[model samples]
Target: MDRKGWVMRAVEALRLATFKEIQRYLDEEGEPFSKKELLDTLKALVAEGLLEEKEGVYRPARKKGSAEAFRRLFGD
Candidate 1:
């Protein structure tokens, strides 16, 4: 997977993470990424609405359709 993909995977796995936490997760996953590159990717993800950030912490964005999908798969 690409850097952005790896970053997204890290955030999804972590549920919520700070920059340093993401960096460490990537390192442990054997994917060494520069701070600038990671930051840029994260900003792009936030802009694209694929991830959300607050107070320097990042998490996967909860899309409007996700709740509908969940209800379909389970129940109201």
Candidate 2:
């Protein structure tokens, strides 16, 4: 998947995570996304309305459309 997609999936699964948490998760999955790369992707995702960030923690944006999108893809 693309960087945005990969980051989105990570945030979706995590619900909320700090930058390092996301990076560690990706690293565990063998992604090797650098801190800068992850930060860049997070910024882009937030700008594109795909993710949200607060107090340096990131999560999938929980707007109605995004929630429905997740439900459709993952169920419940």
lDDT of 2 by residue, 1-76 (tens): 8998788878887889999888888888888797788888899999987787889988887767777889979999
Overall local distance difference test of candidate 1: 0.95
The lDDT, on a scale of 0 to 1, for candidate 2 is 0.85
Off by over 4 Å in 1: 66-76
Candidate that scores best on lDDT? 1
Where does the lowest 10-residue lDDT sum fall in candidate 1? 63-72
CA lDDT, every prediction?
Answer: 0.95, 0.85
lDDT for position 8 in model 1:
97
At residue 9, give the lDDT of candidate 1.
Answer: 97
Model 2, position 45, has a per-residue lDDT of 91
**How far in Å is the alpha carbon of 4 misplaced in model 2?**
0.8
Cα lDDT of model 1 by residue, 1-76, tens digit: 9988999999999999999999999999999899999999999999988999999999999876878779968998
